[model samples]
Structures are given as C-alpha cells and as structure tokens.
Target: MVGVLVATHGRLAEEFLNSAAMLVGEKEQMSSVCVLPGQSPEEFLELAEKKVEELDTGDGVLALVDIAGGTPNNTMFRLSMTHKIRILTGVNLPMVMYCVMERSDEMTMEELIEALLENGRNEISEFGKR
Candidate 1:
C-alpha cells in the first residue's frame, strides 16, 4: 500500500513512468523524478526530495533507482535514512511493471521489493535468432 517513486539519471525516470502508464493506462501510486546530466548534486537532491515528499503520504514511499552509487541512488539512500521510505536500485521495465501489478491491499513492502528485484533480474532473451 506504499507509494512508488521512479528516480533516475537523465530522462529515464520520467520515461519509465510514462512507458508503464502507456502499457497499462494511468496509475495512482506511482510518480517520477528525472535527474538530468550536468545538473548539480544539490539540484538533484532538491528535486528528488520534493518528489519523495510529494508521494510520501503516510503509506510510505519506495524509490526505484536506476544505478547503484550513482547520483539518484545516493540521494534516495540519504532520504531513506530520514524518511519512512525504502529504496530499490537497478530499476528496469520489468521491475516497474511487476511492482505495479503486485501492489495491492494485501502486499507488504518486503513482497513488493522481492517482486521488483526478481522481475528486474529476469533475462530478456531470444530463443532463436531471426
């Protein structure tokens, strides 16, 4: 029942949310923040913090970051320490898709995190070459 935030470098974060919405229509529990290149760390932090706060409405917030040790991930991590939010790095289409699907009245934070990580790890492979 927690809120979801997609924060990533460049336009990836916004694109993730947009693509998911396009694939399955509009959603209520999701939002995004895009950290463009050449932006100062302070700027990224402000934007990310604002996005997290906007989504944080008592159910808690979960931030899906694109890369570990990067600006977005690091900023999310810092916010997690102070806010009631969880962070799942290495985000992908599968992760976002699965999270939205499994999120419901009965799903726990642990369960959603597991689904995101597991689905994100699923290989998109071709069985036969064209």
Candidate 2:
C-alpha cells in the first residue's frame, strides 16, 4: 500500500490522524508531522523528508497538506523530485478517512492520486442552503 504522511501547520496534521484512527483504527505506513510556531520552513522540510523516508516501504508516500504554497505543501513538492512522493492539499477528515480506509495495497500510484483528488473535491458541498 502507499504510505501516507499528513503534514500541516499547527496540530492539524496530528488531529486528522487521530480522527482517522478513531474511525478505522490505526493504520500501518501512516504518520503525521506538524509545523509549529517559530519553526523554520527549512527545518520543517528536513523533518518531513525524514518522515517520508521512514514511511516509504517501496510503495511510495502520499503527503496530505493543509494548503497549497504553505511550508508543508512546498516541502513535499521539493521532496517529490528525490522521492516517490505525491502531494494533495486541502486535507479534511473525510479525505483522511478515505486514505486510511479505501487506499489499497494493489492500487497503483496513478490510481491512488486520482482517487484522492476526486474524493477531496467531492467531499465539499453546500448542504444547508436550499
């Protein structure tokens, strides 16, 4: 299966992982990283690289970040050139649940990326305004 690294600013990454774990139990090849206040982007990048290396078990890693152009997202983008890492931004609980529950070991990298992009977009909607 593809490994997952939920990296974001503040404690959001950890919270997402915790919530997903509650729904599907703890998953293997999954981890979280947070960019705290006063933390340099360079330092965060190094930390993210190490986590990616640790999580990657030949299936590569899927990194979920809070937003595009942020430190978490930007670092993962940089790491992508050297590692088999695919990035997805705007992570939410539903997306995390999909990654934890539906991501299969047999799925290819392209398929996983496609599924995540679709699922992430589909999770958002205006429900109460009618």
Could you say which candidate leads in TM-score?
Answer: 2
TM-scores for the candidates = 0.88, 0.93
RMSD list, candidates in order: 2.0, 1.2
lDDT of each: 0.81, 0.90
TM-score of 2: 0.93
Error of 2 at 79 (Å): 1.1
1-130: candidate 2 lDDT, tens digit per residue? 8999999999999999899888887778889999999999889988999999999999999998999999999999999999999998898888888878888889877898888889989889998868
Summarize candidate 1's per-residue lDDT along 11-83 as a digit string, tens digits: 9988887787778665677888888868998998888888878877677888998888998889988888888
Error of 2 at 78 (Å): 1.4
Clashing pairs in 1: none
TM-score of 1: 0.88
